[model samples]
Target: MTTEHIDDSAWISDKDSPVVARLSQLISALTNLTMETTEDLQVANYGVGGHYSPHFDFYHVTIQFIRRSCQIFCFRSGNRIATWLTYLSDVELGGATVFPMVDGYIVPKKGSAAFWYNLYASGEGMIFLRFIALN
Candidate 1:
C-alpha cells in the first residue's frame, strides 16, 4: 500500500478473536466513530531492520473525479479517520509505535495497542500533528 511501508501482514478477523472484537467496540465508543473505524486486525511479522515509514491513514488528496470507466465501475468507500492496532505478539527489539515529532514512543508489550485519529477536529489536518512511526 502507498501509505504503509512494511514487509508483510496477515489479516485477522475480529469475529475469530474475542479480544479483538471487544477492543474494536471499545474504540468505536471511545472515539465516537463507528466500529468500522477499525481496520482488519493484522498479524505482522518483521525480520532484520523491519520498519514502517511514517504515513497518514486518511485519504489526503484526490487525483481526479468521475472519469469514464473509473467512476462507472467504482464504488464509494468510507474515509479512514483513525487507526486501531493491537499487538498480538511481542518483539524483544525494534518494536514500537512512535510519534517522532513529539519524541514519543511506546515499546511493544503483548496485548497492548495504539490508537489515534488521523485528522484534526476541523477535519482538515492531521490530528496527532506529526509523523507517527509504526515499526
Candidate 2:
C-alpha cells in the first residue's frame, strides 16, 4: 500500500481543485473543527487487479515509526481531524476499504466519500483505519 503525509499549511495549495475544495469544506463543517491546512494527502491508486491487504495503520519499525504512525501523531498533536475517503470511481466487484474491528466498511462511491477517525480521545489509535482491501 502507498501513503502520503499532509502538512497543516499545504492543504489549500495542494487541494485547489473544485471537488477537493468542497470536500475540505465539508470536512471542516462535519468536524466543527479547523485544520492546520497543510497538504500531505495520500493518493493511492490500485488498478483493476490490485489491492491493499489488511494491515494496521501504525507500527513502530526497527528504524522508527511508520507512515500511518505519523498520521496518529499528527492527530494527537491537536489536529482534531478525521479521515474522509472520497472515491473517484466505483468498481463492480472489489476494492472496498474495511475496518473489521469497528464493524464498519466503506464502499467507494464515485464523487462521494467515507470518513472515520484515526485516533480517539479514549486513546484508541489506528484501530479504525486499518487498511483492508478486497480482492
Candidate 3:
C-alpha cells in the first residue's frame, strides 16, 4: 500500500465514489463554499484493542510539496483550511477524535461528522460537529 504522512487501514481514491459527489454537493450548498478536488477516501480500520494516540489531522508541510503524490491535482502548494472527519462505524467504547491544544474531543457515531479548521488563533480550532458548532 502507498504510505506517507498517514498510517491507517487503506485508502480508495474518491474519484469514483458516488457518495463523494453527494457529500460535496451537500457541503457546498450548506456552507456556500466551492470545493476544488476530491482527495483519497481513507478507510481507517481499528483492530481489536486498537488505538491511535492524540494526533493532529493535517500534518506539518515540508518545504517541498510540488513532487508529493498526495499534494493535489493541479500541482500547487497546499494549506489545510478545513477538515472533515466522518465516522462510518459506531464506536460504543473508546474511539474519539481529540485535539490537545483546543481542549476538544469527539466520540464519533455512524453517519455523524465533525468539521474543523486545521488551525486557529491559539494554534488549534473551533470545530463544527454537524448539528452543534463548537467555539
Candidate 4:
C-alpha cells in the first residue's frame, strides 16, 4: 500500500460545522442510507508521486473475525457499504482513479464526486470494485 497523508483534523463533526452537516445530509439523501451508518469524513492529501494501491473498502470475513475483539466501534456499526469520494482540487497530471476490472478511469477534477457500492445487498464485498491511484 502506498503511503497517503490524511488530515486527521478534517474529521469535522456535524455539530461543529454547518457545512459538514449539510454534506452529510446530502450524502445520506443520495445513498438512501441514514447518516448514523456512515463514517466521518476523511480528507487525504497527496503530493506528487503519492498513490493508493487497489483495495476493497469492505471488511472481509477474516478481517472481521480478527478485529472483532479489538474494534468495538466497527462491529457495532457494520462493514462499509458504500463510498462517496469528492475531489477537492484539480490535478494537473497523473492523478486518476482507476478500476481495472471495469476499465474505469476517473480523472481528478475539482468539485467532482464519485460514488460506488462497496458491498452487495447480501453484504458480500464487491471484489471487482477496487480502485488504485495513478499518480
lDDT of candidates 1 onward, in order? 0.64, 0.59, 0.56, 0.77
- Cα lDDT tens digits, model 2, 1-135, are 243321121233334577656666777788775645534455666666666666654432432345785767656654423566667788788767877877877888788877666557664555546667653
Deviation of model 3 at 95, angstroms: 0.6
**TM-score, per-candidate, Cα-based:** 0.66, 0.61, 0.61, 0.82
Candidates arranged by lDDT, highest first: 4, 1, 2, 3
Clashing pairs in 2: 5-40, 6-40, 7-38, 8-37, 8-38, 9-38, 10-38, 10-39, 11-38, 11-39
Error of 1 at 41 (Å): 3.1
Q: Write the per-residue lDDT of candidate 4 for residues 2-113, one digit (tens) a residue.
A: 1532222356678778988899999888889888866678777766777777766777866435555436655776788898888889999788889999999899899999
Candidate 2 differs from the real structure by a C-alpha RMSD in angstroms, to one decimal, of 6.1
Output the lDDT of residue 54, model 3.
41
Native-to-model Cα distance after best TM-score fit, residue 23 in candidate 4, in Å: 0.5
**lDDT score for residue 25 of model 4:** 92
Which residue pairs of candidate 1 clash? none
Writing each residue's lDDT as its tens digit, candidate 3 over 18-63 gives 7876787776676665666545555676644555544344434442
Count residue pairs with overlapping backbones in model 1.
0
Model 2: ten consecutive residues of lowest lDDT = 5-14
On the 0 to 100 scale, the lDDT of residue 4 in model 1 is 49
Lowest lDDT 10-residue stretch of candidate 3: 126-135
Candidate that beats the other on TM-score, 3 or 4, i.e. the better one: 4
Candidate 4 segments exceeding 4 Å error: 1-10, 62-73
**Residue by residue across 1-135, what tens digits does model 1's lDDT show?**
544465577876687899878877787787687775445766766555667776555655452344554443333544566677767777876777777767788787887877777666776647354454454
